[model samples]
Target: MVFHLFGLRALEVWLYSRLIRSPIFHQMVGRVHRRVEQIRHGIPPEESRTKLEGSGSLDKFVRYFKEEIQDQMKGKPRNKL
Candidate 1:
């Protein structure tokens, strides 16, 4: 799931914001949270190194995942399940 969609930066940010709650924290805190998320989630160093790797840009990844989710919903009809 992480590879085909939900790319590194988005995953890292989700983990960080879900785990941390300090409005007055320093920038270093945010960086540390991101690193911690990456380590905890076992994201490869090379994979997390950039938003653009191979042919998939971050925007493209997000758009693809959104479309995939929409298609899945259309097929499964969430309330039916």
Candidate 2:
């Protein structure tokens, strides 16, 4: 999700709420899908992949909840979750 769709070559910020059913759809139909479309329209590639070596959205959420718990334990902000 991060590398190809939002590598440094593409926009940094995106609307996370907009979920698509397929990477193929984004590659085919999205605005500025140059990286994906050009190859299919021009030349066939021998390899396709999405890298799985990265922290996911669930990892972020877990980190948040853990920090919130730690903050409450430390009596920070005077609010509990």
Candidate 3:
């Protein structure tokens, strides 16, 4: 049975909110978050060596990755990932 918003009770909302905040939910979310981050990023470095960002963190990473790839293709010889 679906409970419409207008007819929902306080107890229902309270229970739902509690379940959302539970540690189990957080752990599942953390796993998904890490997997997604790894996919978007090539791999997790042992230690990140980065300077302070000025509003273009993702753009900088993308550009640097692309440049490194292009340099390798041109036989410039860079770090092997």
* Best prediction by lDDT: 3
lDDT of 2 by residue, 1-81 (tens): 668765744443333323355576576665456547766688544354554446785687789889888888988844544
Residue pairs in collision within model 2? none
Per-candidate RMSD, Å: 19.9, 18.6, 11.1
Q: Model 2, residue 4: displacement in angstroms?
A: 65
Q: Which order, best to worst by lDDT?
A: 3, 1, 2
> CA lDDT, every prediction?
0.72, 0.62, 0.79
Q: Which pairs clash (backbone N, Cα, C closer than 3 Å) in model 1?
A: none
For 1-81, candidate 1 gives per-residue lDDT tens digits of: 767565887888987896676555666786788789889999754444545676658778899778779979889634422
Candidate 2 is scored at a TM of 0.28
Model 3 error, position 52 (Å):
35
Pick the TM-score winner: 3
